[model samples]
Target chain A: MRLARLPWWAIIIVAGLAIVFYSFFTSPLYRRALIFVTDDPRLTTTRFANVIYDVRTDEGGIRRVEGVFVGQRGDILNVETSRQVTIRVPRADIAALSCEPPASEGDCPVDATITLLRAQISGFLIFEDMGRFRIVTDDGERQEVRKFDVIIDAVQRTPENCPPSPEARCRVVLPLNPEREANQLSGTVLEANADDFLIELAPEVIVPVRQSDIVAVVRYTPAECALNNLVGCDSGIFLTLFVAVIAFALAVVIGLVAGLMRISDNPILYNAATVYVEVLRGVPLLVTLLFVNFALYVWLRDEFPKIAPTLQLIIAALALIVALSQAWSKRALLKSEPSSFWQPIVAAAIMGTTLVAVTGLFAANSDLPPLSRGILGLAICYGAYLAELFRAGIQSIGRGQMEAARSLGMSYLQAMRYIILPQAFRVVLPPLGNEFIAMLKDTALLTVIALPEMTQRARIFAADTFRVFEPYITIGALYLCMTLLLSVLVRAAERRLALPR
Target chain B: MAETPIILVQNVSKHFRTPRGVVHALRNVSLEVYPREVITIIGPSGSGKSTLLRCINRLETFDSGAIIVDGIALDTAANINRVRAEVGMVFQSFNLFPNYTALENICLAQRVVRKRSRKEAIEIARALLAKVGIPEKADAYPGQLSGGQQQRVAIARALAMQPKIMLFDEPTSALDPEMIKEVLDVMLQLAAEGMTMLVVSHEMGFARAAASRAIFMDQGEIVEQGDPQTLFTAPQSERMKIFLSKIIKH
Candidate 1:
């Protein structure tokens, strides 16, 4: 009993907050920022100069000097050190020279933190006149370093306010070659030439990249999404629920109306409902969805415009028929009673106006959005099944119940509302819960229309990551958990509402 | 004899179309009951006694003739609800609403058709439940109550509409032997109060004890009708004799 008294709402609130917090911190923007700050030093590190010169001392031993290579003046080589001093070295004493910045060590000093990329030759300054730089690496492989090879330069941040003179040391990022990070650039190649390929980096921005550089080429099919927000966070679940809940709501309305019509005493109403049920039920749900999305929507967009005016004319003709019927039916009374002459005409005019409005509303919106089409397809398809279910539930009650209510002098509609529907609702509850679960799962089929529901998101994840089994298995587990939870809730509701027989 | 008849059925006939064939359930059945008169109808199986009672309230529409209750014709669509409200019916199986309690079952029609407020309906229902001798069982559902209690509740439900005439169609036939006396006791009290009643029953003891007139019916037609004592003692027709002989032995 004490455990039962525990505040379950508090626990749910805390759990919900935890999920939202986790979703927020791990969002793509924050993840990308974290990567920029923590990636390999070649991408973020900065230095004043990245030059190293190895020369022989007067004692016949070799010593190395690191600085920015200023220039060569005839017999002396000029270099600027981190201490802001220019030093001259006789060209004759020079043994080996390398432009690659040395790693942090006791002998090699750097003004700021910096890291260098590995190449046969590395140098701080490349001679643009020659269009190349020469440096000796630790491996001693003499390779040419071209100016065009360095794609991105150092990135700098704004200088923060410092004391005294207001000058501040700004943090700078190091330049890196584009080839090393080509694996991260996953997109389609827009245009390619011998020297470079024009690649679409994002939807709106395209950049020219060297042909020799490694690039991740990703080919996209028409069905696949290039960018979709519903796949992010836990929005896929929300999207699925949105479709299922809306479709279920619409289906309930349709099912109630059709179910009542199916059981009607009138042949016209019954036949209309029967035809609707037979046609919708005979077609598979997937085919219905495809027909709604592709065939119906396409026709509505392209062909419905031409037919809408004809539909209006047909509706007007039908309204005229209804008016004529009304007038003809009351002709004898009208002829006998002159004061009631305008009654049938007024009634017909009102009914005809209402009919036109109802039919004209549909003709007004020739094209429906994709999401609406998907929801409509699900609703109408399941509505037929639910209509049968509702009919069965209503029929399950004995005839005596109706008679008893009727004998009480209650109108037929009142008796149905007060007696029959309440009992029928009880009888159909468990089946209704089952339909909801089935419909929830059926929402996955809408991925054919490129809806970013849970299953669709999983498909996209599998295609992007090339790990086919993991994403699908995860989605299956999620669906299992959701359905199991829904089942428990429904059983609880049933228990709560149960009455002794 | 001076009072106007509260219910008049004139040449009323009903035919049911079954998959087997069309069968005449009621053939030119006619009856009249004055205000405060208690009439009990006795019949063999398929005698059309129940059909005649149902037609009086238009629960089952007749193929010909007319039924007028409390001077209101049953043929008029607008008058049907009014006539039904004036005439109450109790079924053989005590078709009490299982979804409602005994009190609510009585209150439903009063609140809906009579447009009584909830409090007023509840007050009237409580008074009627007490009158039926099941005041303590008012909160119990029909399913939970015994057949006698359910029948009493059905009587209270019918009386809650303040109807002018009451129609009983084998009201005690579904009850146990012990339970039948309790239901019959309520009907006897109603008879003593001089309520206009039409009862279809096989209980000759009740007919002999309370009915102002006893009728014998067979083959969808009334065979005999007379004072209860005279009709029970000296039957006029062979059909009546055979029916009485067969029923009286039980």
Candidate 2:
């Protein structure tokens, strides 16, 4: 039995779907596996005896604790302090827990702090004295009690040094008795209010104090999260569309100049136009774009301060105009009267100047609302190519037609306008349509300067989700669909304008 | 007798630039054509016949001479187009605008050079086409018509301008042997109506039947000049004798 062959795009789609399905299924599995393996008791028990881990406190100004677990139950543990004090807890007495990897794994050992403020430890704790406490664990039939020595790691001399208000993960150092010694106690504030602060004393112990006793206060600010979001969401689209519009506008101007110059009888104008076209056409579009944005923009910024961002637009317009005008002017100049050389150039100049001035004014005034740059850029770029097409179409008419017109007392201009241009324009329609289609595709270049076009929006979406592939794929599809639609429109126009055989 | 002639030539000479230095196409030649007189010029190839005819309309300027056509001198640029409009020309190739129909081709000169209204030009073109006996073919493009028909259209196009004098440059040369008769007949009819025409042709029968005056040219100079009947029967120059005998024998 033979299987049906899938189209390439279908294959790509299937592969993409498979990848998505696999990733979707595997994501949760990976997360669960990560949690379970890291929390495994086999590693924690072995590493917990020799290594003392500290969960820094907020009140003692991020003090480090050193302890070892000696006794264990479902929710209870006996932890021996660095001075050999063992603390025990009942099954339901533990409030919080965390795990860390062993030191030998090239990473610091995990330190976990458990706060017992919410737990009902009063039922299970044995108070030996004012400064000592113990915990009892019930192991079903037997009660295992562990007793160990107790000593103050460091006695705080002045309790007034603690911070008044504590934020998340903030620490405060307190001097319990400054008259007696210079000893200090470090504690992380577990909770805080305007008048009172709660801090973790040990793994499960928490102490509270009034804010009036404290002498210091500190605040930690969270990292600004909106900047990255803004850059990704807003700036990306804005810059791209901006650049594309500028480039397109420049292209139109270049087309007009080169088109008119090509037809000019003056060697200076014609040669300059030819050179411009040659240079632009020879260079890669990416190179030209970069050169305009980086080099030309920098050079012209001082001289033309009013048109800074629009410098790229100017350069793009100039480059495209040069390329397009050269081709058009050459074709037009060869076939048309010398006076006609000004038509495309004048039209393009007007369009370019108007577009540039408007865009510059808007850009200066902070009114680049949306997609205006992209539209302008596309118009400019395509206009140049169109002018050339017009020239070529005009030239395609036979010389006999011109001579006939002249013989009838029609001046050269009259003959070209009435007899030659009409026929030539019919011939040029197909190629002109092609140029328009190209222009539509080239609009994607707008992303460089942060215009909020479709592609830029997609990028922002991707960055937010940290899933880079999907958004780009979707964007690519959107662009392709748009370009295809434009191509279809151009083809329809070409057909409508096509001359009958 | 002292009054200026309708057309006057004073020692008119023409030289052409060529790769082999200046060619003396016409040399100190002079002639006058009165109003409404049919003048036929007969010459062998390279005898300055067509050049002389073109000079009369100022289409070909002479190097050193004065040609006064209908009262205005040909030397001035100011009167060139005006002169051309008055002295309409029919080319050997029938240089009609191929893109236009016969009627449009005829009407264009009338409307453009003469500044006539389109309606008036069209009416004049139609009448002229009828005069040439090809009114039915007025709507046909030049390319669609035969050589004889196109030549007749060319004649009609020139006449539409309402020129006083018509210069024919070997009008029948490019036509077929049978088609030549049609164009010659039109010329003969024009001549009988006392139209001032300068025609360069080798058609002996046309000269004899329609030409009031026949001038024979050899070596860029007039070899003999007289009435067509007298010129054909007895020539003054040996060159004319040889040329006429050769033509008649053929």
Candidate 1 residue lDDT tens string, A1-77 = 26456489845744654554454355532222222211212222122223455655656565555554334445555
> What lDDT tens digits, residue by residue, belong to model 2 across residues A21-88?
45434553222222221221121231133223333345555433334444445444344453322233
Error of 1 at A409 (Å): 2.6
DockQ of candidate 1 is: 0.25
Question: Residue-wise lDDT of candidate 1 within B117-222, one digit each (tens)?
Answer: 9999999999999999999998898878999999999999999999889999999999999999999999999999989989999888899889999888888898
In candidate 2, clashing pairs total 66
What's the TM for model 2? 0.46
Off by over 4 Å in 1: A1-235, A312-362, B16-21, B242-249
- Quote each prediction's TM-score: 0.67, 0.46
